[model samples]
Target chain A: MNGIHDMGGMHGFGPIVREADEPVFHHEWEGKALALARIALAGGLFNLDEFRHVMERMPPVQYLSISYYERWLEGAIALLAEKGVISADEFTARLTALAEAGS
Target chain B: MTADAHGDADVALRVRALESLLLEKGLVESPAIDEIIDLFENRLGPQNGARVVARAWSDPEFKARLLANATDAIVEMGYEAVQGEDMVVVENTPRVHNLVVCTLCSCFPWATLGLPPVWYKSAPYRSRAASDPRGVLLEFGTAVADEAEVRVWDSNAELRYMVLPERPAGTDAMGEDELLALVTRDSMIGVTRALAP
Candidate 1:
């Protein structure tokens, strides 16, 4: 799928923002997302090609709007649900629980 | 926080939930995840690529091998794994400068170079890197002379690329460690040349 996720050579995204002393991950969840992606691949849930494929399947608007790690998180969720490790209802229920808990 | 920021946080929350679910189902382990994160953050990174570049600078024979067989050469230096399995090192000469971008997705040589910087995965870098390599280089504050050429390599296939930046002119007296100090992650990605010593 030639989706918006393939942003290479497109244009108009603006100048790359350079921050002083940027850490590897801006937020703790970003780190966890990266780790989960790696571990999931390692555990034979999916190959790297599948990982990239899922990210490519993201809706164009959402792909453009989300941050990089957020995209990774989205990919992980899609992979997990597809693999049947977690159901769509379970994912929604968990998100609702997390929302109500205000975490 | 902005709505985008809040949405990002919510995504993170979902990730945490998924992680817990996986752990509970015995599909994955916490220690394994911790180890993977530690490998990326500490053990692997552009510093490893810097070392490879520095070694190539100091040894002509090693440079030949690196340019010829980047994956094996990189593994000789103890950096080899999934994403980096197919690696290619392009050299920067006075006449030609090299730039790398993955048009399909952010397919980087992560085993050696670690996680890519945010900008490398940004829409601007991806879009501009191939369409206007020179302009992108200018944004990176790297001036490619009018007489020179800019070659953009799209890591769109299984193969990934890293730039073996031209050694700075005044660095004849510098040791490998000193030279390594000047090889920024951007240089390897070909957004810029190696910094002058």
Candidate 2:
């Protein structure tokens, strides 16, 4: 569970950035992602502890690269697959379908 | 699309897929998701926390109860949900200040504070808060006296924290609404002091 996500007191990231009038969620996608996460947890799909554990285990590079709700969505997908709610093949197929439709 | 844009689209797709998948499987209801989002997006926020701080400033009994049993006190105010089940309200006085951070991830009191700010989850804050509390506070434009002790709290799944910032001087007659106006999100998070009227 010890990973780069546990980043208290280590350094070099930079100063905290504050916007003039920040909304609760920066993107519409982020709101949906967060909603999915909350609903998934409420429905007994996965608990907070389990979700937090997997989030900590996310690839360090990805952790720093993605946005906050992006991480939440990724962790939710990983949990859904892990818990057998959705199979790995189905997950990949959906992603591929989405990408294909976009192009 | 750029990689980042593609990534964003990908996440959006996954969220939609997961929601439908759960609904099809009878695991969750669609309205529940809508309600949760509505709560965080509209009904909950630091404004909720500001109300609690304002009450504590005006009522000594409430402040004592809040400091002694934060979860109960906060719940009594009708703010109860995920990530806020167990809370510790640390008081800021002349000699001590408190800062809350979740080193492992963003563990926040979402029921009261709504979602955390982007910076609260940034690598910069996670890595530097505890090591340079004074410096971090300074960046937030809060310069604590050299003699005051800075206490950093690490929030987790089991317990979360919010700072009970010092009541600023010269507002003895202000009502709760006026007091609430002076309470900002940063003060509850301990990055800055509550504003003065």
Candidate 3:
């Protein structure tokens, strides 16, 4: 359930719950997570400087849960797509995965 | 109900209330507070238990008894509930180290090991420690030997454990009290071990 820690970002994984035939986020907490993540990305609230603090002050669980990490991911993706940091196809795939995880 | 800011009355009042409530529900023949009161009256805090552990550190035969069956040995030493609860002690060895966690809330070996520490209750530690004992211990600053394989004990109704750490090296001549100083409460519950003093 907390397997997100092992990540270069795992694909097809964003659901909070794991059932035999269904991989889905817990309906209640996920929607909130996505909204928060989107806001952080669009607002430029997370940056490289803030990230070092994440590593220093937060344990693994808190590090990932912080609003800034998801926001940073979203911003990085947007910038990368605009500036050719990665191809558009790769960006779309990554964004879709992030959106799923943010669920 | 809101409790008094001072914790002193909190335990006492709660104990009284629980006894009365249990009695009303017919869970027991009597609402006797003395049963729990007796538990508190005995069972020295971690400091005293550590002293006993230190004695065992120096004494091979005693350590053997502790590893063999901790409950019997502890009762033989005159520590028990007025109505005692059974306790089982598990030893932490060189090849196979043990770490204990009350995954189902805070079921501890209170007879020998007294209480759980703060980190023990955190959802983060409990959820991760069982699956990742090595990582958690490293975070706790316990370095295990490369050859040592860690075993995490998830405590429940049927099985509970207390760790009997291997006596630290280089303290062969120390007296009982000095050895006990090395026996940390956390080590008994197996999150950490007593360090050599």
Candidate 4:
């Protein structure tokens, strides 16, 4: 089953902002992925009653996504915007193009 | 075979020591062009693990022995668990079913079962496995009785588990060699049951 952490279009977020590409690695648990997986597990295991309750506590997709992906073109731009990598106006314009393409 | 950086002491020692040792020689002078092989004595890789499942699937008497004392029964076949104890091999009878999880960290029978899949180590799997096993199995495309009490095993220092999936229907006459081919890794993990068709 898809774990709560399996995102619809969120893999390969980035290693761009990383200043150091050090050989020695420190393992960090992917929190956003874990959370998404937990929500999906709730979908699989819990009854509707419990599922709704758990969903209330889970984060919205917008917050969990990192930046750009092969999917979620808009969220990627928003991440760049939040970092001041792009202006809000630029973010909207790119997102508008993305929305029109899907149509 | 790549473990995350925060792996336990065993992984750290084995991986780091071997890599550095290889580099100390001229074999990998750059250390960047890595081509190191990891080996172990009596490695009970998947082939051995599959044999255990195949034997259990075909022999009722062996299954009984496996259930009564899994570690001892397994040792007779030459696969010995190093870190697990109180091993319980749960038979997947048609009337009842079984699955496994580590509510704590991934406490697995590394000797007999080999490495755990990525999903097995995640928090969602660990948390929901015991309480909502049926739905989890269903999501993974395994059959279950809504009426069947979905037994979820929580592995510990005391109790480690291996799911003996119900030998799937329509393969009674199939020989051991043929049957082993049908036993997917997921079948052993309890996400699905073994089948020949």
Candidate 5:
């Protein structure tokens, strides 16, 4: 797929910013997102190609806007839903429920 | 929470929700998640790659093997794992510098280098690294010699690359452990040279 994620050789994105003393993960959720995606792939929920394809399917604007791990999370969710491991409605309900409980 | 904080919180909530659903459905266990996290955090990372680079610097035969067949050579060093199964170690010489990137996506050598940094996966780095590697290297404070050729290797799903950085001068007396200290992750990625010892 010729998605924005295939960003090689494109122009105008600007100079690379190197963060000093950068940690392995910027947020706790980022690590969990990575672990979940790895587990999802490892458990045969989806293959590596399928996992990357789902992320490539993301809308260009949203794909560019989200952080690296956020894309991982989005891909994991989409793959899980596609694999019948979880439904969209269930995920939404759980998200809403968790948000509500936190508040 | 500020807007950014709220966004972070929302994403955090979404991940938690996903975990809960997976847990409820018996698709995944909590301890398994922790184990994965622990593996990446504690056991896997650039330290592994640094070890490889250090050994290659100290051993002529190992360097020859690593340059000839990186996957088997690295595995011999005990760092074989997923995403790093097919490896190619490009050596940096007096007249040639090698840079690695995944233009399609971030296909890094995870077993050795661990997860990539955010900039490596960002649009700017991905786009420019292939097209203007010398300029990219300049930004990383690595100025290659005027006559040296810059070679960029685009890593893919099936194959990954790591740079065999030239061993620094005045390191003839240094041991492998001391050599490891000079091998930064960026050096293995070919953005910068090994730190001077």
Candidate 6:
């Protein structure tokens, strides 16, 4: 898939923004997202190629707008639902409940 | 918290939701998640790549093997894992420099180099790395000589790459441990040279 993710050679995005003294992860959630993705692949819910393909299928505008780990989170959730490990309604209800509790 | 903070919270909530659902369904365990996080944070990282680069600098035979067959050579040093199974180590000689990028996505040698930096996966970098490598290097404060040829390696899902940076001069007296300090993550990624001893 020649999505926006295949960004080689086309220009004008901007200069590279290099962070100083960057840590392994910026947010706590980012690490969790990474861990979930790795676990999903290791458990054979999806192969590495399938994982990359799902991320590539993300809507281009949203794909470019979201942060890196957020993409991981999105891909992992999509795979879990697709693999029948979890249902979309179950995920949505849980998300709503969590959001309400926090608010 | 600002608007950006609210946005982050929303994404955080989504991740929490996914995690909880997986746990409830018995698809994953909490302890397992922590173990994965700990592995990447503590056990696997650029320190492993630094060790490989340092050993190559001090031993000519190892360097030859590393350049010839990077996957087996790196595994011999005990740095083999999922994303790094197929490895290719490109050397930077006096006349040629090598830079690595994953044009399709963020395909990196995770077993050795750990997770990539945000800039490495950013659009500007993914786009310009292969096309305008010298210009990209300049932004990283790395200026290759005009006479040297710049070679860009586009890593993909199956294969990954790491740069074998030239050992700095005046380091003949330095041992492997000392050499490790001179080898940095950027050097292995070909964004910059090894630190001068």
Candidate maximizing TM-score: 5
Name the lDDT value of residue A85 in candidate 5. Answer: 82
Error of 4 at B124 (Å): 1.7
DockQ of all predictions against the true structure, Cα-based: 0.61, 0.61, 0.01, 0.02, 0.62, 0.60
Per-model clash counts, in order, read 5, 2, 3, 9, 0, 0
What is the per-residue lDDT of model 5 for residues B18-51, given as tens digits with 9 covering 90 to 100?
9898888787898999998888888889999999
Instruction: Name the better of 1 and 3 by TM-score.
Output: 1
**Over 4 Å off, model 6:** B1-6
Give me the runs in candidate 1 sitting further than 4 Å from their true place: A99-103, B1-8
Candidate no. 5 TM-score: 0.96
Q: In model 6, what are the clashing residue pairs, if there are any?
A: none
Q: State the fraction of real interface contacts model 6 keeps.
A: 0.76
Expressed as tens digits, the lDDT of each residue in B55-80 for candidate 3 is 56777898788778777777666656
On the 0 to 100 scale, the lDDT of residue B115 in model 1 is: 79
Ranking by lDDT: 5, 6, 2, 1, 4, 3
Model 1 chain B — which ten-residue stretch has the worst lDDT? Answer: B1-10
Best by lDDT: 5
True contacts kept of each: 0.72, 0.74, 0.00, 0.00, 0.77, 0.76
Q: How much lDDT does each candidate structure score?
A: 0.82, 0.83, 0.52, 0.53, 0.88, 0.86
What does the lDDT read for residue A94 in candidate 5? 92
Comparing 2 and 6 by lDDT, which wins? 6
Question: Which residue ranges in model 5 land beyond 4 Å of their true spot?
Answer: B1-6
Q: What is the lDDT of residue B192 in candidate 3?
A: 75
| Cα lDDT of model 2 by residue, B1-197, tens digit | 01242455566777777766767788777787777778878998999999999999999999999999999999999888565469899999999999988877788887678888888888888898889889999999999999999999988878889999999999998999999999998899999999978
Q: Compared with the true structure, what per-residue lDDT tens digits does model 1 show for residues B108-182?
A: 888668878877777877878888888888888999999998899988546889999999999999999999999
For A1-103, candidate 2 gives per-residue lDDT tens digits of 4588878767788888877668987777787778878877877889988988777787777777877887788888888888888887887777677667778
Q: Which tens-of-lDDT digit does each residue in A30-76 have in candidate 1?
A: 88888888788877888888888887887777777788887777787
